[model samples]
Target: MECNKHNQPLSLYCPSHLMPSCDVCISTSHSKCNGITSLASVVEKTKIENSKESVEKDINYFLSILDQLVTSKSKNIKTGENHCIGVKKSINEIRKEINKHLDHLEEKLCQETDIIWNQEKSKATDFISEIEGKRENLKEMKEHLQTVTTNTSKLQSFLGVHKIEQQVHQCQRYIEDLENDERTKEVDIKMKQNDEIENIIGKLVSIESVGEVSVVKTEINLNKETSLRRKAQVKSQEQSNINNMTMNIETKIKINIDKTIRDMICLIDGRFIVVDWHGKVNLLSSDGKLQKQLPIPGDAYSVTQINEDTIAITYPKERAIKIFNMENETVMKVIKLGKLCNGLSFSNNSLAVGLRKEEIRIIDLEGNTLKSIQVQSESYLYNLVYCDKRVIFSDSRGKAVYCVDDSGKQIWQYKQDLMGPEGLCIDTYGNIIVVDFNSQRIMVISKDGQDSKVLISKEEGLVFPQCICFNHNESSGFICDYYGTYLAKFNLSFG
Candidate 1:
């Protein structure tokens, strides 16, 4: 083989190398062979190496993808299996719950059906029993009707016989004859008895005892004696009753006078005020000594002690009210009302004045009217007393006493057979005491609006009680009589 200057083989070298070469050269040439066969061999070896590496790389990538796919498929299968199991379990649980609910519903339905069946059975039994009872009653009625029909047929058959009719007529004629004989005998016996009675009466009239009794008039005398004795007894009883009533009245009067002299009349700070119906305002001492006599400008309807030294007076005729200061002996304020004034009271920093037209006017101390309350009434307002947020008054026309709130709404009212209610007072327990003018009686009514009890019916010792006042602390009251010239007192007690 020939080698080139670069020591390549002739076949591996370029076409320009055409020379002989040594073994080393041949070896070097073969080592550095540039022939097509050598190049083809190198390319085939590199392709095999690259193809093996590529196959190895592709195998690794495919194995990795297969591993991922297997892992994902296993996970998905497990998830699907678990989901199926869960679905089966959930389905089983739902079926069990449905079975339980269905069982409960079936039990409830069975119980309700049983109840309805039992009720219907009972109703059917009752209806059957009722039908049986009605059938029995109908059978009994049929039997009774058959018996009644048989009796009626027998009566009809008996009534149809002519012999029986003739016998009945004969019997009736015999009865009439016997009745006539009895009547004749009765008349004859009556005549004989009358004759016997007349004879006995004649004998009795002729006897000395009968004639002596007639002559003496014993029965008339006995009756006269009995009547006289009865009259005497009655007279004695009436006299005894009169004495007892008189003593009671006297004792009550004395007790009342003593009580009124003690409790109702009080000396407030050495200034004495006499509560009376007179027009004059008498300022007296504790010993009943008149100190100053101040004549009112008009008719003094009411007198109230405002304080230790102040006194209020209502003059209805003048339609005015005046406050008198005893210490200064001067008038503090004078208020002229537009309506007729009747009664006055001081409470809760205000003056409550009663009017004749069934109204109450609340005024301050300075003579300013704050509120006016119209009392519902069919009569004139006679008197009023304010206590416990209630205004109690008497109505002359209605013959009753009424209590109203501060707003003029009626709280209670008591009707009586009084001729006219003139004065009214409330006790400590809110009992109403009324003075009747025409009936001449002291009527006491309970606070709960009951009937009026007659405390003093007639003025046997008293002329006429005009006004009344109560001492709440003592449970006592006083009444001023118009003609008695003294105040009567009473101590009240519960029955």
Candidate 2:
């Protein structure tokens, strides 16, 4: 067999369309098919015996047969065999006593002889009737088998075999039904111990006395311990009240950019690096003053601090990460990413970068890709953070935040009404902070993604906050507004 289009022997199969193809066809026609696997691997996995449908079908057939047989046998079987044996022993003991008492001439004369003879005669008649019914069924089966053997046409013989099989099954079912009938069951009699009388005698003998416990009171010592407990509780209550009270927050403009600032990172020295939509990486002073601006190759989408003096900016459209040194204020290097790089984070001496196709890649300083984690999502990952050996990222289209370990295994995911979740960061308490641009709020979630609450909202004068970053001050964060062009600095509190 050969491929009609390629005019070569079919050596490959395209799983996308389930078509056999030649090597030339595979390279030319089905080059972009991700599901195109080797024909040998497909055959080895999907043979007739090893196929999923075949295995399921065989298992279902066997289970059906076993289920029917078990049901039929259970109907015919007796459950309380041991109980019946005990009952029979008791009945025989009573019979022996009855015989002993009736062995006297006077007792025999007093017995109802007619009634006893009638009962025995009725049981013998019923047994003879059952034997006659079985004999008749056997005779009918023999005649039917002989007629089936003499059938002429093949179709008639096949139908006759099926009919005879059904008849035999029917007969067997009739016999089982007779055996399980109440009238056919063996009778058993038993005399049980008088449990009521035993319980009454047991209650008469026991008289258990459990004494009441009491404590001698000392007024002064008791009062002292109570006062100390009250003081400790009041102190604990004061601390808890402090934790629950909202602080007098202060918001300041830490940085201002003329263009749309997409992301910001706080360096250890109190300076900040902000990347704008116009592909400008700006160095800002601690109090919102633009110190210097460096022009990069493409539109810078995200910026992350790699060290105390270096920051990396991601250009999604250009598929490159430009690393810049803050002390010398120069572009150190640019790593070329083959796919769209949306988010950049530093952890374990590697870059945790998010791609546009919902995947996270770990790359070293030398640009060598270490491992790639597919997020298994339909939405694009816009922002991510590396913390606690977990890559927590936000999917704007999916409207969710996902946490995955280094091996691409999912730890937990939190989904809420997040409209365009863009910037992601982890606070000092390890809580995930996300910026929802449409909702104009900052969402704070626990590390495990279980507890989530709004940290900042539109009521706090945040207008279209796009990016978020934790500050070095520990309890404060920087949020950049896309439309406002100014960063909002606010103190973080739990209440």
Candidate 3:
């Protein structure tokens, strides 16, 4: 019973109540046994296996989720990396564009800055030049002030010295008066005492000889005082003479007013002549005082003072050139020119006339035509003057001037670049004075044609300069303008 109780053999297990068993246990004991431990073990094992299967399935599911998450994460990482690379590339491109734009902007700024710098530099240069000019002017003013100050100081010193000299002279006079008063008082005392003493001395000298010697010494002293007074008077008189001489010299040095005289032509008799624009020919003294007005048949365009009595004038509107005797006031001869004559000059017994056709016609005083020469383009001749055995004329339309010899040969020609050459005058040095109408200037041309100078342009403020006439000695000249009522005077200094 004890052995059966411990081992429990059992056919008592119902087939329907079979315990769960593993295949290993069934193989180990081929028995239908209700072995709760084995059943529990098998059941526990099945449960463990199911639990393991579930865990494995869960693990597989988790692993698949993990794999999907890892794959998604990897894709996300790759995408992020690609995105980063793209963003970096875009940023680099943007940086490059920005750099290029900045470079272009910098270049444009540099160019503009350079232009601004140049303008500023030019302004600065102009400012500097202006400052320099102002400084020079200031320096000149300072120098002038210094000179004036020096002169003022010198004048003040001279005045002070002069006043001191006057004071000294007054003091000397006072001293002389005092000395004279003392001498006179002493002389009076000597004289008064001498009367009293003479009585005493005469009685004493009759008694003693030494008293007479003292009387003689007193007389010698009186004579010396009288000589000293006379010398003082002579010195005062000499000083007065010197002062009077100085005053006379100062009075003689008087200021003179300079008077300008112009357009003076020397006649044969040492008188002078001038042609006024009012159509009057005035005979003048050498001092420029009007002497007389010569009578003429018409308004004189040109006047030649042949001598003090004989004068020739060209009257273009009257179509006659006339020689008149001033003393008789009569027309001596009249030369008729059919065309309009403008200018006239007398040289070498011949009259040179400038015709409207730009021709210079030479005729004698008796109206015999000697020669004719074309000077410039037709219809351009305006004025003619004789100089150095040549006839000089100006051509307005041709803008030129020409000089021809007495034999009708061209010597020189000046092509003026101005609009018109209207007036002609010849200086003593054989220089030509040309008045240009358009430019309103005076041109000086030498006879050799090698030297030309603009003597007066806008500086003279001339408008429509018409006629120019040179003085006989060529010291000065005169110019007339059609519109300008006043005359212009010019100084001529030729080398």
Candidate 4:
């Protein structure tokens, strides 16, 4: 291979610079460089002799780990299915209660209305009969008067006329008495219209939705006992030889800021960026001393290192991701997106964005959309980490952790006793560390999905843990105690 800089064949290796040098390049530039060695010698020393055997052993080890994870996840899937059946049964029970109550109301209302209609009909029928009787009496009096006037002599007619007149007067008096009675004046029953009652009936027994129902593989343990329990179980199966191993924690810096801390990211230069609930990003030294604070245009929820001197932050409210250049301490560029940016992770020269509705949009550094990934979840995806060509995301509403491939296929999910998983990070050991806000604990899970453990808890004074990050070497880590108004630092003692 020719050296791109010198345009000549590589001839020697320089240990000081850790790169291959050409003859002309070494003579002119690397002549004073220390630890110069031949390229053949360096290659022979670093190359493995039994590469085939080593590959087989590595393959078997990884395959065994994969088998264990598959078994565990299969059990979780069964549990999730059972939980779904239980939820459906519960919903049916509630529906039965609602139907029973409404049916009773309908029966009672029908009976009451029937009684009212019968009473009103009886009053109407009685009024009609009384009017008919009066008409028949009047007809009889008119016929008798006509017979007396036509068939009798003058004197006889005079006597009969008086009697007929008396009869007519009587009939007239009866008719006037009927008119004077209030009950005779158009007796009828009617129901008055009531809009309020109609409105109430329409609103009663209506279906109201609470939230979405989705089946997810939830955690086996819900509190800070996950790690301890798993560790005890593993330790019980074997004997330990190492001694004097202890994990120690300390209060690194307690900055009493009134603002709520959303997330914190550790930089390679021993500085940390603390994002708050508001639009402020605070830069602090590794010792927790305040250095400078930058104000973003919108609420900043996530911060991640893009390169050695540049960091990317998620501005969900503005639907944009801004690149913050650390050297200038200013926003260098803004990648405007059609969807809102929530969780963010930069890897393989691409940015995996956790958008709304549990979707991850993969975009290049230039803000062009490469692909969109929809996670197998109904809840929103929160903080995420990109490591080893995979995206590890936390679902705050679902209370689970999900890992997905580049093509948006879910590999496996881990959930147990997790309340609200927010920010996640991959440690040097390839273990996933999650900060759960609702449970106020930090959980660590192996990348293979076989084991999980709790690193810190509320008992350790971690109140409302938001974000967790490891330093460059992963020997030490930092936790943002959001509501506690402090930062917790812990040292890892690997046994």
Instruction: Please identify which of the two predictions, 2 or 4, would achieve the higher TM-score against the true structure.
Output: 4
**Evaluation by TM-score, superior candidate among 1 and 2:** 2
Residues 288-397, candidate 3, lDDT per residue (tens digit)?
45577776746666766565678777776677788999788899998898866757777787888877654778888898888887654433344678755788777666
Q: Rate the local accuracy (lDDT) of all candidates.
A: 0.60, 0.72, 0.59, 0.75
| Candidate 1 clash pair list | 2-19, 12-35, 256-489
Model 1, position 151, has a per-residue lDDT of: 41
The reply for model 1, stretches above 4 Å from the true place, is 1-278, 284-291, 295-298
For model 2, residues 96-156, the per-residue Cα lDDT tens digits are: 8857874874465446454565676688678779869877987887888788868368888
Task: Point to the candidate with the largest TM-score.
Answer: 4
Cα lDDT of model 1 by residue, 1-495, tens digit: 444465544343221243334445546554554442433344444567666787687667667766776787688778777777776687678669968996996798778777776776666676567557656655665455444545466666455444445655655575577556532242111112344455455434423231110111112111222111334433321111111111123222322121111112333454345544335566654333556666446556567778887878887668888998877788888889877675787777788887765579888889888878876555545477776777887777667788888877777777758788887777665667777888888777766665456777774555566766665665555565653245555666553
lDDT top scorer: 4
Off by over 4 Å in 4: 1-247
Clashes per candidate, residues 3 or more apart or on different chains:
3, 1, 0, 8
Global local distance difference test of model 4 = 0.75
Q: List the residue pairs that clash in candidate 2.
A: 254-288
Rank the models by lDDT, top first: 4, 2, 1, 3
Off by over 4 Å in 2: 1-249, 254-256
Q: Better model by TM-score, 1 or 3?
A: 1
Q: What's the C-alpha lDDT at position 163 in model 2? A: 85
lDDT of 1: 0.60
